[model samples]
Every structure is written in structure tokens, then in C-alpha cells.
Target: MKPTDYINEWVNRITPYSPGKTIDGMTKLASNENSYGPSPKVIAGLREKIPEVFRYPHKNLHVKEKLSEYCRVKPENIVLSNGSDEMIELIIKAFKGPIASIYPSFVSYPIYAQIYNREYISSSLNQDFSFDHRKFIKDAWKANLMFLCSPNNPTGKVIDVADIEEVAQTGKIVVVDEAYFEFYGTTAKHLLLQYPNVIIMRTMAKAFGLAGLRMGYAIADPELAEALKKVRGPFTTNYLAQEATILALKDLDYMKKSVSRIITDRKAIEKRLAEKYKITPSYTNFILADVSPMSSKEFFDRMLEQKIVVRPQPKFNGFEGNYVRITVGTSEENFLLLDALSKV
Candidate 1:
């Protein structure tokens, strides 16, 4: 008779994804967002599109065309979504089979798989968080869908392209989440041509500084792209998001400049943090450091007392010791963070 009884048993067992917390006046470096923000042109353009909100969003043709050029794929090979998160869900919904990914990678891969009631499998990363392709391939052999994150979340480590190729050889639907590709400057796009089963997911949230607009896309073979379009809800991407993405794509230079700055700051933070903590080399705008000797929660709480926020990675599978993932903020914010770390 209870509403809970109506839910499937599998759905009841799922643990939802937890995002970083924010407090007023705190320097939030928890979530890996572009702190530099979007380009001036995108802001100006979005203001112009406000009055047009009365109308339904048009088909994603213009955005798709621009992204096609940006990604060097045909327009038909692209599918737009609310964000890359939705694209992940769509892929899970459209495909049927066990979902697999490496442990300590993107949390969404397994989380989404559970939401859709699909079997989720995972392989553990090496002690240093380095991925072993052969081990992953063997473990994920039974999976029909595989998700891989390069410049992986939390750790900011990139998967080698050769390892990606070896996984794609398994012939499963390989999803390469390149959400932070702009910072890393490499992609698995080359495999898309050779392997029709490959899907490359990207987002405007990171380097583009359009996290508020929630725009993401995927590039796949035209047939697979069409299938994803069928599964995704129509009008999921709104007018403002579409227009903002188009504007962001046009101002590639601004994004590149922001990325250059973040990368610089990322290195500075890594160098400083390495003096104490064991810092992992990063290709993205964030750094993961082993805060051993202090529990991750204790470190997080100490940062909190200073009104600074950073992500603790205790819940992620394969994380051996106390670790925290710090997003690279502006110069001022980074200075504040370092000052707080020293005092803590």
C-alpha cells in the first residue's frame, strides 16, 4: 500500500550522486568548474536571447553545425543534450547490457548505470591511480557498454590513447568522457572513424565557463548518433543554452586563454602541495593530492574553518588513503587556499 512498494527493488538500493557543497562567502574550489567564467560575448549574446524565451527552442541544427566544425565531425554525427550528464543517461537507456568503467574514475558512470537498473562492473586502478588497460579489458569483457574518462575526474590523470584503442577492440559501445578535454589538449576522436561503436562526450561546463547553461554533446557514427537522438527528450536543450554554446564555440580564443591560465595555476598549486602531500600530476584544471597523516575529512574540515571548500575522495572506490581533489581557482583564490593550507 506504501508508495515505496511501487518502486523497483534495484532503484531502492541505488545511492545517488553527491555534489560538492557551497556556503556563502566561501572560496568554493570543490567542483571542477571554470572560475574565470564565460566570455563577454556569450554574456552579451545571452542577454539578447532572453526575450525569445517565450518561444520553444528550435532544433539543434545551428549548435550541431558549429560543434561539428569544432569537433571535426559531420553535423549528423553529433547529438546535443542538457549536459553531458544527460548524454550519459541517454546512452545507458538506449543500450542494453552491463556497464563497465575503471574504479575511481567518473562517479556518474556507475551511478547512472544503477539508476537505469543496468549491471555495473569496474576494474581497480593501480596503487598510484594509473590505469591498466589489459586488466580493465579483461574485467569488462562481459560489458556491453564501457565508459572511460580521460583527464579523469578527481585525479585529473589522462588515459593513454593506446589503452583506449585496446578497449575499443572489445567492440562494446565505448564512451570516452572527454569533459575536460580543453584543458588536456588531446582526444580519442581518432577512434570514432575506425570504430563506429565509439562515442565521445563533451561539455561546455569546464573551459567554456558555461556551467550554468548546462550544454553538452556527443560525437558518434551517424547511425549511433541518430539512435541517441531518438532516446533523448526533444527540447532538453533550451534556447539560451543553444545560443550560449554557439557563442562559446565561436570565441575559442577566450576559452583557450582561460585554459592556459588555469593550467598555469594548476602547476603552481601542484608544486606547492607536493612539498607536503603526495600530489598527482594533472592534465586538467584540478589536482588530486594524498593528504595522508590527516584524514580527508579532517583536512576538508580545516579548509572549511578557513571558509574554503575542497572535495574529499574517501567514497570513491580504489582510493587508498586520505585524498582531496582541489579545483584550480583564480590567482587570488589560489593564494587564499595556500594561505589557509599553511595555517591548517
Candidate 2:
């Protein structure tokens, strides 16, 4: 039999989730990465900590300590990982739950759910691509684990706190993925005091400008937080990534400045696009644009030819047809994207 036939059923059945292109050879606005590189101090910190790479990393040390202080939570309440990607995978392995998430969410949830052979349920977003809390809560109650993205990926719509609280009351473990939190200026950290079952996941990749470092964290009650320790790969985080994150935390001012720029540019892009393209108000660093004039395939092809990459919404059940997710990029890059859109 072919190697494909011998592959695990779930693995063979899975359709890989597509990610945005690398910026190396293109005007990359496809992946929603912070255009501003890692905090300047992070570069300096990595140089200073280069020697730490020779020895095995200390189990619990400065990075976790500094992160806890920054997050205003106890060190015990945080579990750092290679990046938020590892955190998501850990959540799937640690919890035996019927996985549920709102549609047009971070693509990884369904990927991980299938990997674990768990029941994965999905609810659709509203027509405007905003989350409908009533449907979310209704579906969440039946799930053991639910992934909710704030300033939701691709769509860029944020759910109100009142609705988030209502869903938290569903009494299941609610994993809120705030990958784009800094861009939006909203958070679910306050909900942690009231909901013990809530796990707030934040990525250094998007807002902190540390996507290259691959570091992220989860905040939860210490008991529940510790449960994830089993799946956490010891030494999965490298010395450089740890050093970079600590420095990024120290340069909060620099991080905030970059975040401010992204917010400003996001609004500008939204307004310009809305004048001609069917664009929605995005609170995050990306916008979901419906290019119904062209078929989704044609839209994708045209953008690729222009060397600009954007995500196409998959036509799964309720989600159909030509919508592309455009990430906020630098002034020059955004202008390049505009130029391409103007032509198409």
C-alpha cells in the first residue's frame, strides 16, 4: 500500500489549514503579523543572553516571572509555550471535550480537534461576520471546550463583554484566543476573576512583534493551569525566544507605540476599502473583505499574480463564496495592497 494509505485515519482525512505567506520575498500582508519587528530591546536582550543557549534552559525562571508581573497574574497561573500554537495543541490534548468554536475562527481548532479524534462542533457567525453570542452560548453549553477569538481572526469583530460573560456562564472551559488583543484595545483578563473555567490565551506573535520568537501564554486558575504542564514540552522554548519575550515585556512603551500605529492604519485601510470594496469595520489588525465581483478562486489568483496574499474564507456549510482576509501591514505595504485592489 502507498504511504498515504498507511497514514493515520484522522491525519489522512485532515485538510491542512493554510497560513499566510512569508514576507521574505513579497509585500507580505497576508499573515496578520506585526509589521514593526520585535521590541528593539528584545534584540539587545537576545545578544546579552546568547550564552544561555549553551546550557539547558532552567525550568522556571526570569521569563515566566517577568510575564506574570506584566500580566498581573501569579507565575503559577501562567504556562508559557513555544508559541500560542503549542498552547492550542496542549488544550486539545489535556481536555477530553466536545470541541466547539464559532465559524470563521482561528483555523487551528478544527485541525487539532481532528488530530485528537474529538467531536468538533461549529456555529456560524452573523452575516456581517460578527459573533452571535446567543448561538455561541447555546452551542458552547454542549461542548467541553470552546475556542472564542476576540477581534476574531479574518473578520476582526470583537464580542462585547456582556456576551462573553453570558457564554462563560455556560459552565464549560472557555478558551478565549486574544491573538490580536493589542490591536483592538480590549481583553477578557477581567473575566478571569469571576470565571474559574476561563483560560485566556495571548500571543506575542501578533501584537508584541515577536512572531519570530514564537512565544505565547495562557492565564487561568493555578490548579487548572498546572494541569496543562503535562503536555508542555520541556525545553520546547529556546533560550533566544525566552530572552526576546522578556525584553519585549520590558519595552512596553515600544510595543504600545507599534500597536497604536497598527490601529490607526487599520481604520484608514477600512475607510478606503469600504469606499469601493465591501469591507467591514475591523477592530483588529486585519479586515475581512467580500469581493463578490470576482469569484473567490479568481480573487485569490489575481492577488497571487500581484504577489499579494490574503486568506480566502472556506465554503464550509454556512460560509460560502468570495471573501478575503487582508492583514494590516506597513504604510508602504498597505499602499501596495491598495494599488492591487484598485487594479482588480
Candidate 3:
């Protein structure tokens, strides 16, 4: 038999995640990447540290220490990864005995569960895409790990604090993915003090503008953090990425400016889309537009023709229907997307 026969059933059963396209020869608004680049200090730090890459990363101090100081968590409470994507994998690998996250949150959550051969129990969102914790809590005891993405992807909505606390009280490990936290200005990091089962993940990809560097981390209780560490491969984060992240954190002013711009631009985009296209508002760095006027595939093709790329969320096999997720971009790029939409 061929090697394909040897593959695990779950591996064969899994559907690969379709991410936002990179802007190779076009302006990309498909991924919610920061329009502004990373901090100036980050570039300078990388340049200064280039010579040290000849040696293996120290892996014990500096980067973690800086992160600890910035996040106000103990150094032992942190686990570094190539990106928050790896942390999602680690959580599933470490604690997923049966089930994982509900549906329509991060697409990767279910993918991670499938990779671990766990049964994914997907709870759907309401008509408005806001999470209903009551439904998830009712089924919580069945899962050892539960993934919650605040300011959830695609829908760009968040779960309230009270709802998150109730889920955390269920005694299951809760992985709160705060990938879009900077744009929304809310987080469950504070809840960790009361719930040892809670783990908050943050990424440098979105607001921090380090998507290329692949730096992400998790903040959790010391014991749970150690459990995740056991599953993570050594040196998942490289020496340059670590050093660049340190500088990313050091230049607080630069990060603040970028976040401020996103917040402002997000509001403007919503206001204009509402007035012009009659579209609804989104809470995260990206917005989901109802594509009922045209087929999602057709609309996506039109956008591409205008040299713009956006993600079309396929409404197939129990997934939401007729919607596309558009990332918030720079003022000029955002206008270009609007211009394309107006024409179509």
C-alpha cells in the first residue's frame, strides 16, 4: 500500500485552514496585519543582535524576563512559541483528552483538535456572532481543554468577562486567545488570578507588527504553564525573533501609536461602510461584510481584480453562509478596498 494508507484517520479527515493571502504583487487586506511596521527599536535591536545568531539562543532569560515584566506575570508563568498558533497546538497536545473549542471562533482551534484525534464539540454563536457561554458551560465538563478567542476571528466579537469567568469555573483548562486584544482594549489576563485553569495567549503579529518574526506567548498559572512547556519543542522561537520581541516591548510608544491608529481607522471604516454599503460594525481589527448582494466567490474575485485580497468564509457544511472577512488596513489601503467594493 502507498504511504497515504499509513496516515492517521484524523489526519486524512482534517480540512486544512485557509489563511489570508500574502501581498506578493498586490495590496493585501485579507489578513489583519498591522499596516504600520514594527517598532523602530525592534529593527535596531535585530541589527545589533545579528552577530549573536551564530550561537544557539540562551532560551532562559532576557526575552522571557522582559515579557514577564511587561505582562506583570511571573517569569515561570510564561511559555514562548513561534506564534500563538503553536500555543494552540501545545494546549491541545498537553490537555485535550476529548473535545476542543466551539465552532465559528478561530478555525485553527478545530484543526488543532482534529490533529490530536479529539472529538471537537463546536457550539455556534448567536445570530449576531456573539458567544453564548451558557451553551458552552453546559458542555464544559466533557472537555479537558476549551479554546476561547476574544474579539473572535472573522466575526470580530468578544465574550463578556462574566461569561468567561463562568466557563473558567468549570474546572477545565480554558485557552483564551487574545490575538486581537489590542484593537478591542479588553482582556481576560486579569481573571487568571482567580482561575488557575485560565491561560491567556497574546501574539506579536497583529498590533505589534511582527508577523514575519513569528513571536507569540501564553500567560498562565505556573503549573499549567509548565505543562504547556513540556509539549513545546525547544527553540520554537529563534534568537533574532526573541531579541526583536524584546525591542518590540521596549518601544511602548510605537506600539501605542499603531494601536491608536487601528482603533481610529476601525471606527472610520465602520462609519463609512455603514453609511455607504449599509454594512454592520465589527469589534476587532477586521470586519465581516454580508455578501448576500453577490456570491461570496464572485465578490472575492472582483476584489482580486482590483488588486485587493480578502478572505471569503465559505458557507458550507454547517458553517456560516455568505460572508467575507476584510482586514482593516492603512487609510490609503482601506480606501482602495472601499473603492473596489463600491464598483462591484
Among these predictions, the greatest TM-score belongs to: 1
Q: Select the stronger candidate by TM-score from 2 and 3.
A: 3
TM-score of each: 0.98, 0.93, 0.95
**Stretches of model 3 off by over 4 angstroms after superposition:** 276-280, 316-321
Candidate 3 or 1, higher TM-score:
1
Per-residue C-alpha lDDT of model 3 across residues 1-344, encoded as one tens digit per residue: 88888998679888898778886888898878887879877887788888888988775478889889988888998889888888888888888566656567788888887888887887777766767788887766588788888888877878898889989998888888999888888889999999999999999889889988898999999998889889988878988888888888889799888888777887877776665343546667788777776777887898899999988877834644578788888888878877887777
lDDT of each: 0.91, 0.82, 0.82
**How displaced is residue 4 in candidate 3, in Å?**
2.8
Worst 10 residues of 3 by lDDT: 272-281
lDDT of 1 by residue, 1-344 (tens): 89989999999888888898878999999989898999999999999989999999994899999999998889999999998999999999999779998888888888888898898998888888898999999899899999999989877899999999999998999999999999999999999989999999999999999888899999999999989999988789989999999998899999999999989988988999999999999999899988989989999999999999999887555456789999999888999988998888
**Order by TM-score, highest first:** 1, 3, 2
Can you give the lDDT of residue 187 in candidate 2? 86
Regions of candidate 2 where Cα sits further than 4 Å from its true position: 1-6
After aligning candidate 1 to the native by TM-score, how far in Å is the CA of 276 from where it should be? 0.9
Clashes in predicted model 1: 0
In candidate 3 the C-alpha lDDT for residue 190 amounts to: 93
> Global CA lDDT of candidate 2, please?
0.82
